[model samples]
Target: MGCGRPFDEVIAIAPLQRCHVMLSWCYLLLSATMTIECLDLSECQAALGMESGAIAAQDILASSSFDEASVGPQYARIRTDVAGGAWCPSTQIDQTRYEYLQVNLHRVHVITCVETQGRHGGGHGKEYPTFYMLEYWRPGRTEWQRYKGHHQNVLLKANFDTNTAVKITLDTPIVASKVRFVPFSEHLRTTCMRVELYGCEHKEGLLAYSMPSGEFYAGHLFDDRSYDGSRNSSGFLTGGLGQLMDGRTGGEFALGNGIVSDAANAEQWVGWTKPLVEFYFLFDDIRNFTALSLHVMDSSNSIKEAAVSFSLDGRHFSHTLVEYFRYENSSVAPGPDWLSIRIPKQCGRFVLVNIRNTGKLLLISEVRFESGDAYDVEIVTDGPFVGRISSPSFEYVWLITGLLGCCFLCALLVTIIAIRQRQRKVTSPSYTGLKSTPQAEHIAVDLKTGQMKVIRDTELWLPFLNAKANSTNVYMFDSDKCAVSKILEAPANVSSVQPAESASTTPLIPLKSSSSEEDSHCLSRKELFFENMRSEYDNPSLHYAASDVRIVPLSKAER
Candidate 1:
């Protein structure tokens, strides 16, 4: 801060002047290193919507909303307090693990910092998040991953009061298409928050890369532990990218930084033993190539030489450059090297790095693609850059639209069918068809007249009832015998009568009352005899007979 001045002399300066000097000194450091709290923000300061109205309303989402029309996720914006005073959670986060405000960037970008504010009800709101954690998702990621820089899960501090914004610059920025802010607190209270993301577009367009499997050494695995890409049967990383792009570069192994146990060294370096190693990087699309910087542990020149190739497709790569950087060092421990290999006006979607082995051991730490365009957006290697950020496709829109239309038509058809069925049910033939009975014709029935007419005019009804009862065995009483004995009864008079021959005159028989009209409707004498035998013949011995008839044998005419 001083031109090599003594402490006694420095103290002699005025206190106000000293503060001014200190502020200037700090500003210079911030401008020079672009570092704060040991974090390199990369000076990529572009507002990702929230306060700038670029994110849009539909892009914001929440676990819940206090009032969707008023306190919704869209209301969450840094430095402003409108629409129900920031975005308050529907419920207090008391003794809860998660409740979040989410934003979909629609595409991936390097998110270097996040600024936050509480419910600034024009300085009336007390609701603000005390602490929060971030989770993000990007291309090539199957699920959301929580960001932990240097593998340490840390919470970002948030605003304590309303209105005033507090920006939390990440030591390790995040590259994602979507991000979630999960608020937390030690005390029980409702929390509302507004936020903004600061960074630039990830123009490198590097999506994923395939490489040989890492090698093991000296009881330690010199592997990319963070490489989330797929592994093949042959132990190669078939696809995906990890630590190689995360801004946190592997430092001097002898310095003992980013190391695990006593040998964090092995964990950060991507090592291979093959004499000729090949690396394939896939970009989301074609991009112009300017220069590529690589951080490698080549103090011993274990990696002798390398070649660069650019290709429109994965196959038929066109060679760009090859150089031999091999050298022999007699030092006890070989150190790391940084190589900036410039591409001569090349452009392609695929980049191939062919590294030749010199000492049977090769280790690489980091890879960065630099551009000369004004879109010098910082690609925070410390953040997740698993795969290239892909632009949205129009085909997906049409497909979704077609699906929705089909669903709507199906629902309409179902509704129409349901409605018609209901109408049919309400006015069906079962309820309002024929009024006449199918079982019998209607007959005018005056109770007394109907009874007298049935009794006087119809004798078949009684016979039918008797026959039905006999056939159905409906009346056996208690005895288990056939009705034949009851059906036939012997007359009281058994004396035989002389048979009459020739054209026989009608036989005369006495009947009860031939005076009333009922006499004409009554059963004839023969029928009375038969009906009496069938129904009233309960006893065989006791019999009362007014007349008797004897059976005669069938005889031929006059014989």
Candidate 2:
């Protein structure tokens, strides 16, 4: 457990709560403190009770081989074929010298026991050492120490017979990797034997430990009926202790295996080994576990009372987790057997459980330590592209709806205004085409008879005035007194004809040079043209005028 590391280099056990609890140990602090530095021994080849140790035991040394001439068959030889015998010393050598076989485990281990086998003969023939002793060497130690018995005392020699196997069960497991087997008495000069070592692997806590860390140790006893807990020297949660947190309910104590308490005398409830024993658990740092539970069988030996406590540092445990009380009384005839503690919301990494064994061997089928709070784990789906808008919420929906409503309202108002303007244009009156002037006058003239007429109702001529002007003249053809106008030029021989007598009675008006006025009365053009022509064409006068008689005035005829 001595790690050769510097003091300043500290390995973080875990960040407060992330570490997992592998087992509960009574003396973990003591072992942690002894580890001067912990190398990554995960790759280390040696450990307690390793099944592969026999093959890894390569560095073999011996006092003398039976055949010094050839060291191949006389020294350590691994048995490959049953027909061929392994390394054996010469029988002819003197029996006075001490003989020993040594192997290097290549790494440290906490050895609990060892098993040795005699040389097997094909038939009834076999060979074994008469007496032998087991010894081991620590990593940095030059001296060897004899492996002790179950009572923590060294024996001179453990006696054994030939052809029979001898098993040495150690009382206290030792911490070493290299071991030697010395045969004091053998039937032959060289002993033919094989050895096996069993113990826990000396390692860092799989998480944290250093050369200068803390150390602690506690011995545990499991119910002999179910599991061989005593055989587990590593103090790991194996057998019934391992199944304590399996999350099973009812019959927990007697589920796969049962936990039996140590035997105790009557009237003395507490015993050194059992009946009343305390168990300790350590976490990497301060933690608040939810609950602790104990399951007992419905029997006389079921646990009647228990208590719990907590500690931050392994030393001080002042907080009480639970007080003692009888969980299952003897009066109850086979009912549910379970005891639970609320844990009092305490924050600590160390927990102490004190259990009572009721006279008879207590059988606990289950134990539980709920580590954390109940929670739901949700796995969010992440897409490759980010910054995408999330689904619209209720407020977003309302805001969008309000904006759309405002837009629709504005459009409706514009449509109403446009309809009102169109209606005003349709309802109001409009005047178009020609307007009458006081100076302008219209005279209707007849072309055939050279007669001129005048009329009053200006509204009656609205159709003609509103009509678009074109080459074809619009006039009334029937005698309906419809108003119409035409200009007639006089005939070419008008000078040979004479004017009517009424035409002479109408005095001819003189013409102005720049006049656009319609003539009120028309006379023969030849007489007027001859009189007006100061200069003339040779044939006739070029200036021709129309002659028409004007109708009588409306004001003088009808009243």
lDDT of each: 0.57, 0.40
Q: What CA RMSD would you report for each candidate? A: 26.5, 25.8
Judged by whole-model lDDT over C-alpha atoms, candidate 1 comes out at: 0.57
Top-TM-score candidate index: 1
Q: Clash number for every model?
A: 8, 31
Cα lDDT for residue 333, model 1?
Answer: 51
Q: Residue 333 error for model 2, in Å? A: 8.5
What does candidate 2's lDDT look like per residue over 231-278, in tens digits?
223332221112232223333222223322322211111112246656
Provide the lowest-lDDT 10-residue window in model 2.
Answer: 205-214
> Candidate 1: where is the Cα deviation over 4 Å?
1-41, 94-98, 139-143, 152-166, 184-189, 212-241, 247-249, 253-277, 288-291, 315-336, 342-347, 370-559
Worst 10 residues of 1 by lDDT: 476-485
Candidate 1, residue 294: how far the Cα is off, in Å: 1.4
Off by over 4 Å in 2: 1-115, 118-127, 135-192, 198-304, 308-313, 318-325, 328-353, 356-559
